[model samples]
Each structure stands twice: as C-alpha cells, then as structure tokens.
Target: MKKKLIQYSDGYLNRVPILQFILVTLLFPLWGAAASLNEILITQFKVVFELSDFATAFVQSAFYGGYFLIAIPAATVIKKTSYRVAIIIGLLLYIIGCYLFFPASNMATYGMFLVAIFGIAIGLSFLETSANTYATMLGPKESATRRINLSQLFNPIGNIVGIILGKYFVFTDGASLESQLAGMTPAEAEVFSQEMLQRTLVPYQFILIILLVVLLMFLFVKFPKTKPETSKNVKNKVNLGETLKYLSKNNPFKKGILAQFIYMALQTTVWSFTIRLALEINPNINERFASNFMIYSFVAFFVGRLIANVLMTKFKPTFVLTIYGIIGVAALTYTAFVPNMTAVYGAIFVSVLFGPCWPTIYGRTLETVDDKYRETAGAILVMAIIGGAVGPVVQGFFSDMFGSLQLSFIIPMLFFLYLAIYFLSENKNDSHVKEESKIA
Candidate 1:
C-alpha cells in the first residue's frame, strides 16, 4: 500500500503540464525580487529623501497597499476571463509601473516613486492572485501544497538576486548621506539627492527590460487548457456577498488569513529594519556593507525553503510550519534581549524560519475552500498582505517612540508566537479529524 501511494503521487506529478508549470513558477521569483528590492528601497529612500523611519515605511505601505486595492479586481478579471488573460494583464501593469521609474527619477520626486511602486504592486497583486491559485490546480489535489511549495522555492532565488543588485548597482560608496548633507550647500545637496535618486532607478531599469521579455512570453505562448475538472464555466459568476458570507464561517480559512497577515507583518518588519538594526549595533559600516547581512538572510531563506520542500513530502505542512514558528519566536526573543552583534545574527536567522510560512499557510488555507471559491478566496488571502504595509509602520513608530530598533523587534516576536500557536492548534485539529475517520 505504501508503494502504491508513492506511485499515485508520482503519477499525479507526471500529469502536470511541464511548460505551463514552468511559466507560472517563473512568476514566483519575479515577485520575490520585487519584494526584496523594497527592503533595499526603504534604506535607500531614507537617505535620499532625508525621511524619518516612519516616513520610509510608507514605501511598503504604498507597495502593499496596491495589493490590497487591486486583488479583488484581479479576481474579478479571472472570473470574467481566464487565468491567462489575468496574468497578461498583470504583466502589462508591472511593465507600466517599471516605466514610471524613469519619470520618477527625472523629476526627483519621492511621491512619484511611491506612485510608481504602487503601480508595480498592482501588477504583482494580479500575478499573485492568479499564479498562486493556478499552481494549486496544476495537478492532483493531494499534492497541491507540495507543488506550491516547490514553485515558491524560486521566489528566494529572486530575493537573493534583488539583494545582489541593490548591493552592487544601487548603493553608493561614500560617507553617509546625512553626514555629507550637513556640510554641503543646499544646491549641492539637491544635486547629490538627484544623483542618488537616479542611482536608485538603475535596478528598476533592469527590472523593466526583464518584465517586457516575460510579458512577450506570456502574450505569445499558448497556455495549456486547464483540465475540465479544474476549469470554471461561465455560469459560475462570482457573487461577492455570498462568497464573503460563506468564507466568514470557515474557521481554518479565517485562521489562515490571520496567520498570513501576521506573517507578512513579521516578514516586512524583520527585513525592512535589518540594516537599521545592524547599523545601530555597529556604527562603522556603510549601508552598502550592511546589506551583506540582508543577502545572508535571503540565502538562509532560500536554504530554508529547500529544506521545507523536503520536509513537507514526509511530514504535514502545518507541523513543519508550527516548528518553524516556535524557533522564529525564540530567535526574535533573543535578538530583542541581547542587543549585540550576536543578536543581529539571531535576527538574520529568523529569515530561515520565515521561508516556508507563506506558501504553507496559503496552501493549507485553500485546501479547506471549495473549488468555486478558490479564486476569490485567494484574492482575500492576498489582501491580507496589507500586514506588510501596516507592520513596518507600526514597528517604525515603536522604533521612533522608544528610540530603539532592538525593542521594536518585540512586535514581530509576538507575531511569530501567534503563528506557532495557530499551527499547533491546526495540527491538533487535523489529527482529531483523522482519528475520527479511522474510528468510523
């Protein structure tokens, strides 16, 4: 029986259309790269615009705020058209957003940059809403979580690349901007700020060219028709009120949304402030040099995702998630209390713990949802990414209030604790359900 189960799993995997799967999986890294760049942007923008920590966090607020606003509309497009159509639309929006960077840089306007970031996020919202749900439907239901986890593995690769680009192409080598500004004439400062803003646009230029190529691929390449079992017909128009009413009572799905919200908050806060925390601990390093730690963190995140893929094949995803959550909470706790270079390393280690939570919670949440509701449900879940927007601002507020980046980490620690408890409860419920099934 064990051998037969293995064969069944293999057969389900084999049935997946490799080309379409590859194309959809490609999207994972693109968004990963985009998100990683945001962390870099927070630091860069802080220096460029002479903004406060709370003001810098508005970068995430604008970016993820786009996700919250566009998600439901993206879902509506999917229901009205097809996943292919929605994906193409998303790519178009992403391309347009990238182009906005040119005007933003030329004008040297921080608000324009925020507008550009918002556009890019809207595009990402569409891609995530389509790609995540589409990945689950690619093969058999039994392997859904594993398949999504496998695809998400590429996301960290994108993250690593984004950090590398920021470290190399974006960050300038010199005295800190604040120090330089204190001595410079206002005219010199304006010139220096414009130069810095132009440098920030370099990565986006590279991103725009790549997005154009990907957009072409999506436009011309014929995606395989979804199997009938997974396809929706025209009769199944979405009713927002009814969908919300149904989902309101779904305990697991609701918990998953909450988990995702808290997880995003934790993730954004940790990455957004890693450099700030590093500088606080050791004042000697430049922003460029400090970014090396962020790179290390992404590498750890990549490694963690690889490990998670293997673990989930043999163990339940919630069990793996619960374990990671506990470790994450412990690590953040140490980081908060220690306030040393060792604590910095501990904070970076939290990335490994975070690597798997997004996909695991996402897949598990959708598992409880009916197929008809999957697209809209996925949209609502993606909407929870607003936590990314909200978390950093709150952390920034705390950082400013207490004047301690270290103390602010307590916020994420609590968030991690919530995830650990959530998944532990889920694991118990899953076991209870299995035991009852056996008894019957």
Candidate 2:
C-alpha cells in the first residue's frame, strides 16, 4: 500500500500541477510582508510612544505570540477539516487584522496595536500551518524540501518590499522620529504623533485590499486535494497526553524543536534590532538609511535560499545545516566582539546562515516523525516559534541593561552555538541514513 502511494506521488510530482502550485506560492509573500513590517513598527513605536527597549520588544511578543497561541488549534482544524478551509479562515482573520489597524491607529494605544498584530498573527498562524503542509504534499517526498524552498524564495521578496514600505510609509522620515520630535513643542508633538500613527494606516489598508482579493480567489479556485493518507478521513481527536508521550520518545524530533526555537529567536532578535545596531555604530544615520540594512539582510536571505537549494541537492540537509550553523557562529562572533561597521555588516551577513535554518529544520523533523503524527509534529514546531516572542525580549532586556545593542548580540551568538551542536549531533546519528539526509 505504501509502495503504491509512493508510485502515485511520483507521477503527481512529475507534473506538479503548475497552476495550483503557483496559486499556493502566491500566499507565501503576504504573511512574509506582514512579519517583516513588524521591525519598522518596533522602531517607530519605541520613539513615538516613549517606550523602553523591553516595552518595544512586546511588538514581537504580541506578533509571534499569536502564532504560538493558534498553531496547535490550527493543526487540529487542518486535520479535521481541509487545508482549503484552514486557508480561508486564515485569510479572513488577516483581513480583519489589517483593517483593524485603521481603528488601532485612531485609538493610538500601544495595546490596541498589539491586539491588531495579534489578530494578524492568528491569520498567519493558520495560513502557515496549512500552507507548509500543503506545499510539501504537492510533490514527491524526495523533492518536498526543494518544493518548499522554491515557494519560500518569495518570502524574502515580501520582506524586502515590507522594509521599503516601512522606510517610506511607516517611518517616513530620514532621521529618527525622536530626533524630529525634539524640535517640536508640546502642542506640535501631539499633532506630529497623531500624524505619524495615521501614516501606518496606508500600508495596512493596502494589505487589507490584497487579503480580500486573495481570499476571493482562493474561494473560487479549485485546489488539487492531496490529503495525507494518515490524516484523511481520520477522526479528529487531540490527545495531548498521547502527543506528549510520542514526542518524549522521539529524540530527533525533540532536538528539532529546540533548534527551531533557537533559530526563530535568533532570527527575530537580529532583524528586530538591526536598525538599532546600525545606529549605534553610526548615530548620524537616519531611520530610512538604517532600514536599508534590513533590505540587505532580506536580499542575503533571498540569495541564501537560492544557494541553499543548490547545496541541498548535493549534500545532506543536516550536513549543510551544520556548516551554516558554524558560519553563523563565526559571523555572530564578529557581531558580538567588534563594535564597528564591520560588526554591523557581520550582523547582516548572519541572515545567509539564518535563511535556510527554519525550512531545513522543518524538513528534517518531518522526516523523523511517523506519518500518523506529522500534522501534530508540524504544529509543535510552529508553536516553538514562541522563541521569536521570548528571544527578542531577552535581547532587549540585555540591551537595556548593558546599554549597547552590539553587546546584546551575544544572545543570538549563543543561539547559533546550540544549533551547531544540534545539527552536528544529528549528522553523527545520520551515519547509516545517507538517503534520509539527502531527502531531508
């Protein structure tokens, strides 16, 4: 029976239903743009609202927290219903969240913005949980990672666009908002703050329109349903105790979750503070100029995906992951010790290593788990994205305590060190499973 499924999947993968694949890939950039735009919000809100580093870090907390909160439930939904239903639900939530930004800006409260971000995150969580599984299912198991990487290549494109929009629309000025506000009187500052908050509405309003269009398209388009044999027609019952028992015995799965948590934390902290790191190195640099560093990171990320795709073809994903982890440690060493422009560029350079970590980890772990448990496995991994929420706050706390964003990079350095250890450990155990490594 399994052999028959494999033969069927090979035929399905050969042709790969081009139009359906393109439609699914189209959803990739939307959430990517939403997630990347958050860095701009962190910077803008910090100054406009007079927030501490720790307080500003809550922007990430609220954003990724939504993912942690929704991932497990979304997994159940996908397992119980269908991927298409999950995606539609996700899109609707995204639309509501994007439209809420208008009222959130009017309310002009940080908490309201957090609520809006949380709503958007709920949508993203749903989309990501369903979309990732769907993408992998679209092709043969051997080419699953390759297919996911091809689709994910668009993610950084969205990040670049988000950064550009943030540079022009959200932040809008060359200098820091604080610096500009310094010249304003109390009355003028109030007006300026309101106007700055209002500026956020434009991009989010545009996002709302885009989400609505995507939602309608998905509703109308007929997606090829390639439901997993394990999940299809199975009764949906989320037994936490059973899931926990299964995970506890699966060492590779456990390690993969830890690696994912660390990777997410590292990625979120690095991107969230890249601007601050740049400004620390050059205080005269404007917010718009500093944001260009983010564009560089995303560009590196895009390029890294392209390169990693090729590398994965020739080597084991675990082997390549270990090598990237080593490079990350070296780059982060420069970031932590050197406080010059060289260190800031080193920070940007780390994105190349960071780029493939998530997908690699996802692919690696998906291979480790039993077919019956894959959906739950994906959720647990996504839930581990809470690392993004927790990591930045820790880094932000360190930044505030040490009064140096450069020094705070030590947090991410430690994260990369753990990833190196995890990947190397996996590589050693993979000695007998060369075929598994290649596919992973």
TM-score of each: 0.94, 0.93
The positional error of residue 400 in candidate 1, measured at the CA in angstroms, is: 0.4
Q: Where does candidate 2 stray beyond 4 Å?
A: 1-15, 230-241, 435-440
lDDT for residue 379 in candidate 1, whole number 0-100: 94
lDDT of 2 by residue, 68-151 (tens): 999989988877877788999999999888988989999999999999999999999999888877787776777777777788
Q: Rate the local accuracy (lDDT) of all candidates.
A: 0.86, 0.85
Worst 10 residues of 1 by lDDT: 1-10
Which ranges of candidate 1 are over 4 A from the true structure?
Answer: 1-14, 225-238
Pairs of residues clashing in candidate 2: none
Top candidate on TM-score is 1
Clashes of 1: 0
Look at candidate 1 and tell me the lDDT of residue 152: 89
Per-residue alpha-carbon lDDT of candidate 1 for residues 123-217, written as tens digits (9 for 90 to 100): 99999998988887776777787788889889989998888888888886776556677799999988988888888788887888788888888
